[model samples]
Target: MDSEKLIHKITEKKALKDSKELLDYVSESGENTKEYIRYKTLWAMLQTGNEMDEETINDGYKAVKRNVKGRKSSLYINVVKYAAIVVFALLGGYFIHFADFNNEIAMNEIFVPKGNRTSVVLPDGSKVWLSNGTKLVYPESFVGDFRNVQLEGEGFFEVTHDKDHPFIVNVGKHRIKVLGTKFAVVAYPDDEQVKAELVSGKIQFDIHLGGTGDNYKSLMVSPMHSLVYDKTSGKVYDSTIPDGFYDYWQNGVYSFKDERFDSLATKIARIYNVEIVFGDEELKTRTFTGTLSVDDNIYTLMEAFKIASGKPFEYTFESGKIYINK
Candidate 1:
């Protein structure tokens, strides 16, 4: 089968015949090569859908194993190997993480350009999910009392536990410190608000008023709570995480609820890698509430937003840019 057909089978999430055809193709492609490995991972993910639980994963593996038990063939071996890869990749979705080893303390930076999101396993084995248009900087390895890292955009972190070696994330004038935890930080330099959401564990949030770091306010953020700091007014707003919001954006979902169209446009611009110009300033004030898949057409998304606002929205694409009018 061709690449398009194979992707169709995986995405359609349909019958087993499509999966068997893909399996046959992979087995014939030869030993655990890159191509075979890729297919195997996809096949496993497809079998269980995009999301899976512990029980679902277990049952899916056993069922797959049963299909090839009597054969004792190489296909069975390939399936087993694929199963292992899926268990790991699907834990956070399919992504490739590689660490560059350098003996020197030279700083390395990973910049996820507009229109793409990426995940990295840091030197300490902590994983970070970077949203589009984000930059992360750190040393090649950790060799100090603190694992210091800098962030210029939004990122979700799952920090590895280390009591002696504390992990600190520096976001401009503000900083977040943790021993180990899962949390998200949104500190885009241009944005007026810097937001932090703690999913689990405790984190210390510090806001510095000066370069000396002497005059700073600190607070502890508990699990399942979130805080947003307004950079202009220097006011902090605390609230519970809103419903239908999650780090799921790492997996291709651009979800929002009752958000302004202009803000939505900015997010779409980042992911679509496009510049947007609005002919009517009033359009920016409109609000939209919906979930968008990164795979959906940008124009279609715009139309949906207009429909939600009940406004006359029109757009034209030219010179690789989007011009919107009402």
Candidate 2:
């Protein structure tokens, strides 16, 4: 096939009867013929409203080269480049013809570092507030019959209502199923317990344990209720918690009711992005019941704890660590 006729066929998106022969001619052609074919083909595609990125063309070239191995002569190189353009242009046309190709599922991951919190609005309009050191994996768009996401650390979700498409969160060994509900999930990988606190609506929590006869168990949780699953004991417990207690951290408030200092220290360390070392063993058993604003500096927050404890407390910060002594 002549260069002019080949370019015309490519631009018109018509099947070439002698595609191999045309490829051979382009590969054996002189520098002038090769350049003319390359530029003319590009201009024709542009005129036909076909735009392609360099990366996509390069990827297509690599894909074709991987299937056919040998020394890459100038002829082979030119043929590869031409093949890449053809493949990419055909793919662009295919995407244009099938609208659903735009909706192909893609996974997106978000990480929130220590001392910082972040919020994301999902493709379905559901909002998620991620706590410090949290990792969330979600789809770019919902497909199939349900919407699902995976969570690590902690997150507060205000899911949009879609009764037909229930939203599911997979945290550790537990799965939370909900249909338009506000809830908070605390399932840090380092923690021994996973807790799901419902702010409104209802959620079903499923625990999966392999090998046992009653390996799978489901618990329905209502508003104002918190479901706690102990990984060590393999037990699930439900308790009534103060409304919004789970989500207070979203607003920089750390609320605790008779929380041990040991556990509180962990929260403080995560929120302040520091390590807490207790110099006095007795401080670990000390219980605290109050709300502390995380917006304050670490030293100020520690001072509030000292005042609440009514004990002589002192702390030193060094090397990104806080040494608490009494």
* C-alpha lDDT values of all predictions: 0.69, 0.71
> Where's the lowest-lDDT run of ten residues in candidate 2?
94-103
lDDT of 2 by residue, 202-247 (tens): 8998888867554668889978889999999988888997744754
Compared with the true structure, the alpha-carbon lDDT of candidate 1 equals: 0.69
Global Cα lDDT for candidate 2? 0.71
| Candidate 2 lDDT for residue 279 | 95
Give me the displacement of residue 15 in model 1, in angstroms: 46
TM-score of 1: 0.67
RMSD of 1: 11.5
TM-score of each: 0.67, 0.65
Where model 1 places Cα greater than 4 Å from the true spot, the runs are 1-103
